[model samples]
Target: MRQTKIVVTSVEDDNFCKCRFCDKKIAEIKNDIMVPSAEECYKNGNVPVPNFGWFCSQACAVNYETKFDINFAKTKEGKIDYYL
Candidate 1:
């Protein structure tokens, strides 16, 4: 089983860490959380896993891992249209 890494940072200037996958801003109040260790994932002969940063929602996290479009749409001209 693969574990997810979630880094909790202090909210400064009303801004939390942005979602690594979707690039969405995650704003929240500072609180206690239990962060899991990734040492097991890096054990002997284990394949490297990409560290996905903070996420605004679970949907965004899933979309990011699956490479699906959620916050943006692609145009016929191959330009990315952001919905922000």
Candidate 2:
């Protein structure tokens, strides 16, 4: 017989929340509404990520995605574009 150990971490335990785009603390609510959820972090993103993603707006989400992936919002001016 064998025994295995596993560990899990989540952002829900954190005392402070931040904006995924600018890394700013989300201490204020806008018009009584909170920030966007993790599932809406990226442009075409539809899955929940575990790293506490709370974007203030859609533009912030896009900006954050662009920073993570340089080509996330690049144009196909002089590069080969492919669709699959």
Candidate 3:
């Protein structure tokens, strides 16, 4: 199966990126300068959707998914399957 790739880019200034759902500011840096996993990123209150943008929280992600009729399923191997 093909895994989903999420890329996180750093910003020069404080205005990093905005949440796609709530329009909240998401910081590019925190303390350490290491790439975080999707779960880690979501735990920090910012989930990066592949085609879409950043989502503030899981609630927002769910809201967006439901609103757009997008369905996400996790395989037995823990891979996410996205469908309409």
Clashing pairs in 3: none
Candidates' TM-scores?
Answer: 0.32, 0.36, 0.49
lDDT of 1 at 28: 29
Candidate 3 lands at a TM-score of 0.49
lDDT (C-alpha, whole model) for all candidates: 0.38, 0.39, 0.55
Q: Which residue ranges in model 2 land beyond 4 Å of their true spot?
A: 1-14, 27-52, 70-84
- lDDT per residue (tens digit) for residues 1-84 in model 2: 333221212353344445566665643334433344222222232212233345445456566666787333223452211111
* Candidate 1 residue pairs in backbone clash: none
lDDT of 3 by residue, 1-84 (tens): 545455544332444455666767654444533234544555575666556556676677677777889864544654333321
Question: Regarding TM-score, does 1 or 3 come out ahead?
Answer: 3
- Candidate 1 regions exceeding 4 Å error are 1-16, 28-51, 68-84
Candidate 1 lDDT at 78 equals: 35
Off by over 4 Å in 3: 1-16, 28-43, 73-84
Clash pairs for candidate 2: none
Compared with the true structure, the alpha-carbon lDDT of candidate 1 equals 0.38
Question: Which ten residues in a row are the worst by lDDT in model 3?
Answer: 75-84
* Highest-scoring model, lDDT: 3
